[model samples]
Target: MTPTRARYDAVADFYASGWPDAIDDPASLRLLTLLEPIAGRRILDLACGHGRITRELARRGAAQVVGVDLSAALLERARAAERDNPLGIHYIHADVTTWSTPDQYDAVTCNFGLSDIDDLDAALATAARALRPGGLFVCSLLHPCFPGGPNVSGSWPSGGRYHDEGWWQATGELSSLRRQVGANHRTLATYLNAIRRQGLWLDELSEPEPSRDWASGRPDAARFPVFLVMRWVKATAQP
Candidate 1:
């Protein structure tokens, strides 16, 4: 769950409040659900904005929860919540790409944060290094293959191919949130290969359907997958 530097900081207000704790979206729900048996676990949430997932992980039984992001304004909101409610979640303001600790985690999670980071390889390495041997890594993302419909822009700009992997802005009429901070458009193979390169092998995957209301309105997008959730595990060290 890492966000780009100044980009995320600029929209701190919109995200600090709007990105809620409860997992309402299918992708979010699937990601959290895959992060099961959370009791007595140490989890690191990368790109954690305003500690939404961090707070939830602590509430759900993560013994030690750490949230890291580069947005100070968002961390302020998260810290304020901690002060008010005391969730014991530690929030760090740092770029996930450069941040590292000798401490490892039982699980590492990033929710819709991969594309936000400018350097995909560095971000994956950050997540990989945070995990213990065979530790779990769960995440959610916008479907790579989704050629968005109606006002929503697909993974790439219109007239561009899915193979065109690079940072692109969303001009979708309904995608106001993404318009504020554009995302990197990578191919499905790129994401899979990158994770594998980081030694995080795929374990399971989910392509969740969009909400009925949303699908009903955007039939073109409805015909294709909208959200993706993936569970991966760090391969045990080779002897």
Candidate 2:
């Protein structure tokens, strides 16, 4: 694994144990709904953290679900979760940017994982390559316009400004997390660009607001973008 991947592997245990919210995020359910994987279809959960959606897909009766991530630590948690449910999922430790498979999948998913990847474009291309013709790729990211945007200038609910210092960027467009990590910003445009570059067609885009509690804190967030869900389909050969 690359150094980046190694970082996650080393911290996987802590992430899984300490970040329960990360593993049990509602975003997984939301993204899974967009995917709508049929029974007996193969699906790939790119950057499947702690088997959140991977195990969910198995429970929903997918024939085969493969969850791949660069972090062995995260994969270890995923494997442990599978052991409990005994789902027939295959967890592979891999860097999503370069991992390749001879087989194709009916659907590919990456929930809230794209923004954290370093080579966003290369990762998207890898996803495109793994899809069968007409296969769908569904993923979610932090909303690009408000908190997720380059300019984190927004009105706080408490009568102050909540600002994040950095330039807004899209996936593969060069961005950093907390202004240090190599994570990329996954703006809507950036995502679309990557999809087109990979020869896939955009199918849908959605902005999901936070739940009641979160909304209650920053009511204005309802009017702004907080999270984005995107779906793309591979184009088929034409005569």
Candidate 3:
């Protein structure tokens, strides 16, 4: 297994219990808002952890929903939820970077998941291929430009600059999840350029306002964007 998958597998139990079913974080809320009119849309969620957002997609009336992840323990939790709640969300045990499907989807989403994936280009290409022509590819992530303020770790290591893109683990209390599993850091341009390369056109971009509690706690970090939400579209023709 890849380090990312193994690292997360080690922490799957903690993660599965820690996060509530109804997520209220600003980043996730912003992403959900952009996923409107979800009644009957076929959706695929990449790097889906415990099926939180995937369940949300199903709950919001997605016609069919599939969630793919690399963690076996996490997939078990997701499958358990599906068995208990019967949301019809199919959970797949696979990595987003290498997984394939004959079926395409109307919309593809990755909630704060891209940064955790080591092969950003491969993952983006997979997402692109999973989309039907003119379908939507939407995602949210921790803002790369966020220079951390007091107590919080920004998008990169404390010693690392924003332009320094690679893998690093956080040590801050605010970065509980990342501290355990680490994350991949990439520049905004890298993501945009890769999306373009995959024939996914940028449709909308959002830098959501930080929550009052977070802003008050880390004013400096709040000064910069805390989260990024993007919507892209698969073109009818590829380059």
Number of the top-ranking candidate, with lDDT as the measure: 1
Reference-based TM-score of each model: 0.95, 0.79, 0.95
lDDT of 3 by residue, 87-162 (tens): 9899888888888899999999999899888889899999999999999999999998877777688888888788
lDDT of 1 by residue, 1-239 (tens): 45455687789988866777776877887888999988899999998988888888888888999998888888899999999999789988888888888899999999999988888899899999999998999988999999998898888888799899999899999887788899999999999999989988899999989989888888887998889899999999853
Runs of candidate 2 exceeding 4 Å displacement: 1-7, 10-14, 17-26, 148-182
Minimum summed lDDT over a 10-residue window in model 1 is located at 1-10
Candidate 3: give the clashing pairs: none
Residue 12 of candidate 2: its Cα lDDT?
Answer: 63
Q: Each model's C-alpha lDDT? A: 0.89, 0.70, 0.88
What's the CA error at residue 117 for candidate 1, in Å? Answer: 0.5
lDDT (Cα, tens digit) per residue for candidate 2, span 90-143: 998888888889989999999878766778888988898899999999988766
Q: After superposition, how far is residue 146 of candidate 2 from its true place, in Å?
A: 2.2
- Summed backbone clashes in each candidate are 3, 1, 0
Angstrom error of the Cα, residue 147, model 2: value is 3.0
Q: What does the lDDT come to for candidate 2?
A: 0.70
lDDT of 3 at 35: 77
Model 2 is weakest, by summed lDDT over 10 consecutive residues, at 152-161
Better of 1 and 2 by TM-score: 1
Model 1 reaches what TM-score against the true structure? 0.95
